[model samples]
Target chain A: MAHAHESNTKRIWIVFGILSVVTIVEVILGIIKPESLMASVLGMKILNWIFIILTIVKAYYIAWSFMHLEGERGSFKWSIVLPLLILIPYLAFILLVEGNYIYDVYSESFVSWDF
Target chain B: MEATVNTQTEEENVWGGGNQPLGASYGKMMMWFFIVSDALTFSGFLVAYGFSRYKFIDSWPIADEVFTHFPFLHGVEAPMYYVALMTFILIFSSVTMVLAVDAGHQMKQKKVAWYMLFTIIGGLVFVGSQAWEWATFIRGDYGAVELRSGRILQFVDAQTGKRIALDEFAQPIEDERVVHLERNGVWYQSGEGLPSYTVNEIKAGFMANENVVGRAEKLNEDGEKIMLSREETAERLESAVHVVEGANLVRNEYGNRLFADFFFFITGFHGFHVFSGVVINVIIFFNVILGTYDRRKNYEMVEKVGLYWHFVDLVWVFVFTFFYLV
Candidate 1:
């Protein structure tokens, strides 16, 4: 029992190390503005896609490791994460696409509306 | 004697935990619900931000230029560093909270209390820093022009992301100024001219200037104000606009109407979470010192609170990416 718990402690620390590395990657990707990455990938801006993916990955580690969700039963774990997984992406897609449309509407016609 | 019950309330699972220990209670479930609601609130603000970004697709102030403050490096032009630091602070505190819970499981009272104290302090610091960030954002950055139609027209270098100021591009104020006619006529108290600077001032500078002045038109590719050609820059020197003072949603030195609104709403929502997290953490810290969880022997309370603390850090990851990175 003692050895098992010790190994868990070691594993948690490893997860922390991974999270730190991921955050560094995010910061670097944000700052560098690499043209190749900035170009379109998978139908979205590559940089934007990178930011979203890295954020979700970090959120996953926080939940599974830091919150000890990994120890939870599959049902319990999926209840929280699955709902968010389905809902958040749906929201993001709706808002992002709608936002682009609004931009189209706003830019199409120039009315001297500024007074 | 062993007790057994054949009947289980059907609604137990609906309103309460069905299989879990009763004394485990439902407070943590309630916390999850609150987090869900909070998440929705943040989404609403971010969606609004997207709406505004869509509106000013071309001329929107780039996020990178507006948020370039870092610690100990005064005016270092290090954008996104503060939010990154705030992210690390929140996550590290979460680490301490989880350690506290682990210590609690081992019944190390002193260690638990100490770790909880550190976590509480971290939450407080994050909230305070968020306030400072908000203050800097609310106070204008690059002064802008409120066009006659209420839309914002901000100056940008044609090639550089660098923002052009109204003053830099505007003609200098001269002795031969058009003092408000209302002052002499006393016939009408007209609402103030759109801004303090007169059209004549902007025109005078544009007419006299050599540097290209960008005329910010509507976001229409054709409408967008391009820099005057080298010769046109000199000819249009008299009409060049200067930076106007005061607050209007359309024209802030920082960029657009959407940026300010979203910055306040998103950060304010996040700040509120940190504030409440601190309060909850303080309560838990006091309970640890009072040995409440020690008496319970299970130490589950600390674990549940640890979940919440980590959740706050999780939300910040997305906030930082969307607001600062993407």
Candidate 2:
């Protein structure tokens, strides 16, 4: 209860400012869609990579600041975040790779009977 | 006798009711667990969306073109602006929610109530904006023709390089079109409502308009829809079988049908979360005004709901990036 009374309104507002700025930057980039960023880096467009990275930044702030995960004990924080970090990317990777493989098959081998 | 005393103390200190293994209250820990599971659920849906997008990588709908409408700015080609504003509203609401939790920590009843009220208002506004967005999507802008192969072909004026809606240039024709009821048709057969224009009518209208050209769903290297030449468009027009005006489970004017399905499912699910969060916030807001936490000597209830509100906002950031930005 003693620690509960401590005020961190200033910090909350700062995080909010960061989130708003990040969102605005994302929107501006989406609108402009610079040609340089349109080029593919590994497989995805550089612009898409930028958007995903910014989104992760925003998610980190929302979890750590607004949700107060930073105040939680280290073990508990990891218990929550670690599962998501490990599982989500694994799921995304498997699904996306399979989908791309299917796309290749469709383009290279699967011939439509309509022709 | 000394050993007995030590055993009693150890019993009290053991990993039972008195333990705070995670340094979190029971309810808060449970809330975090629920949030973790819920996050995985959302990720499953998003990952599925990614799979479908990759499967149709070259012909996937351009999100900017699909979600171009803005409220009160009719027929204007403002892209990403409305969704961006919605994102701002949602994030602002999240700020107010966290502020309420902070004020609750300080035991400021009035401040907590004010912030909660702001958060609830923001939630309602976000839900309303999402509804409008869904409506705009279901009731499409530029109508398209569906080829026999389930590909969409949108129209653009060749000179101006802008989309032209079906009603704008599609000529009127009278026909004896009737909805097929189960009794009138085959024993188990029924039909959905007919589109405004038939395929022959569209073909006739397209033939009459010399400047209008068909834009295929496939994107070229530059990531723009491949615009067919006039002769190619005319040749492609011969295969057109149906007019697709808006989105539904069966079809959409958007390039990929799966895109509309994922859009409806994911956003609808997220909107449902925001709706429930508002309801929870209202309950807690009332409890705050009633001074329930004041008597309880803690505002942990508010903190729990704050966690939830922030979680919703967190999910939206991903949705915005994947659905709209990327």
By lDDT, who's the top model here? Answer: 2
Q: Tell me, by DockQ, which candidate is best.
A: 2
What CAPRI-style quality would you assign to candidate 1?
A: acceptable
What TM-score against the true fold does each predicted structure earn? 0.78, 0.94
Give the TM-score of chain A in candidate 1: 0.82
lDDT of 2 by residue, B72-172 (tens): 99989899999999999999999999999889888899999999999999999999999999999999988999888888889999998889898877887
Clashes of 2: 0
Q: What is the interface RMSD of each candidate, in Å?
A: 3.1, 1.4
Q: State each model's C-alpha RMSD to the native.
A: 6.0, 3.9
Mind giving the per-residue lDDT tens digits that candidate 1 earns over B1-326?
A: 11123124433464564644332236665665566666666666666676666656676656676787665676578877787788888888888888887787677899989999999989988888887777666554555654444444455565663666667766767665454675588776655445545656656655565453444533444223444354543343333353455343444555455666677767777788788888888888889889898788656678778877887887788788878887
True A-B contacts kept by model 1 = 0.48
